[model samples]
Target: MKNKIPNKIHIIGSVGSGKTTLARELSSMLNVPFYELDNVVWKRHEGHEDIRRTEKEREEYLNTLISSNTWIVEGVHNEEWVSNSFLNAELIIFLDINYSVRTYRIIRRFLLQKLRLEKSNYNPTLKIFFKMFKWNRYFEEVGKPNFFKKFGDYDDKLLVVTNKKELENYFT
Candidate 1:
């Protein structure tokens, strides 16, 4: 499976499903650059509020990355704007872990971030933590079904991993 992985890989999954972790691992193993869609969407500025990039800017940034020879892009976003990334990807990994596991990870991540043990892209707050749970629920109820309906055509290149064990086995 590792040998079968292509140069251009895109990973999409529900929140706390380890998209970033897997992308970083694969990027290191495959020696490909990795991109986080959140970073592209939210522009982080020191001592100032983070701002979202304009639609055109986001599209251009994504296009530039996708045009590269080899790269790994990971995010929970599976929107129409990001369809080009899906189309251009040689391989797409979808993490479909169970809700219980995902929720646990979400809480664990929040605790770690709050304790300063783990770094987060955004500030960790009580409101944001609860919102994560809601997002997880929304993804499970709505996002997953939509993803299946939309990207089912890409089954040839799509790999659905249901748990951490499967994910580990795939890269072994």
Candidate 2:
């Protein structure tokens, strides 16, 4: 169990921004529970359309973790709706890795998924492809503002980790 101080941690980034990778690493480093928002957003089910139906359900699940004293949550959702997690988090790490880096990672992830024929609840279509591109662009444009709004200028509770070396240094 995590103590009250620094118990809650949140990570924000685009797809393939290494959010989960860093979260898992931090969980081991800090000895705290790590919660992937993807898992919370979609309940695993056998060919069920309703499995990932409601944002409300996802929000509720997150609320449960926020109520707890210790948790590290990672996802690429809007900062507005997900503010509660950050509000509780003693630290918030945003991975602002270069667009090329994230693009490479996403492409690699796609290839691996295709090779394994893995069944993911999330969309793996061209729509998602464009979405990923748009997300990367938004990170530079729209997303940065929200990030700053929630975790920067007004707040000093955020850490922006842009490269593997920076991440390593922070965790080390």
Candidate 3:
């Protein structure tokens, strides 16, 4: 790793792509706070019932996070409202891990969550588990391409990671 790491970083990936995992590692290594985009979109509550934030609220909340000096923001969202994160970030990581790899993770995660071995923000219901698969496919077919189209201009800072080892290499 270099003496100086990016102060503001944004990470985007499909479900089970390890976005949150990377963010947490970086946050711990850099001693910075990290926020997940899922929490930004949904206000979590007890008993696994979450409320979706309004467009205006989501934007405002995101803005507040990006306004910080040093942070790692990770999520699967890439849209107009999230443009500011890209603009403000010193590093943007696109986790393009293999589709099959992510699928395996989804299954593993759901089983762990169901067994209470893993802590998840939402309930590990059958419906949500199926949706994870659907979301992963959607990301592969639509989200990944859309992200490249939308954020390609940030190539100077963008790090397209196809494998986790590449991330370690980046830091070392």
Candidate maximizing lDDT: 3
Can you write out model 1's per-residue Cα lDDT over 119-149, one digit (the tens) per residue?
A: 8878888999999999999999898898889
lDDT of 3 by residue, 68-150 (tens): 89999999999899999999999999999999999999999999998999999998899999999999999999999999898
Q: Each candidate's lDDT (Cα)? A: 0.89, 0.76, 0.93
The clash count for each model shown is 0, 0, 0
Model 1 lowest lDDT segment of ten: 1-10
List the candidate 2 regions with Cα displacement exceeding 4 Å. 1-5, 53-55, 117-123
List TM-score per model, in order.
0.94, 0.82, 0.97
Candidate 2 or 3, higher lDDT?
A: 3
RMSD of each: 1.5, 3.7, 1.3
Model 1 TM-score? 0.94
Better candidate number, 1 or 2, judged by lDDT: 1
Error of 2 at 86 (Å): 0.6
Runs off by more than 4 Å, candidate 1: 1-3
Q: If the candidates were sorted by their lDDT against the true structure, best first, what order would they fall in?
A: 3, 1, 2
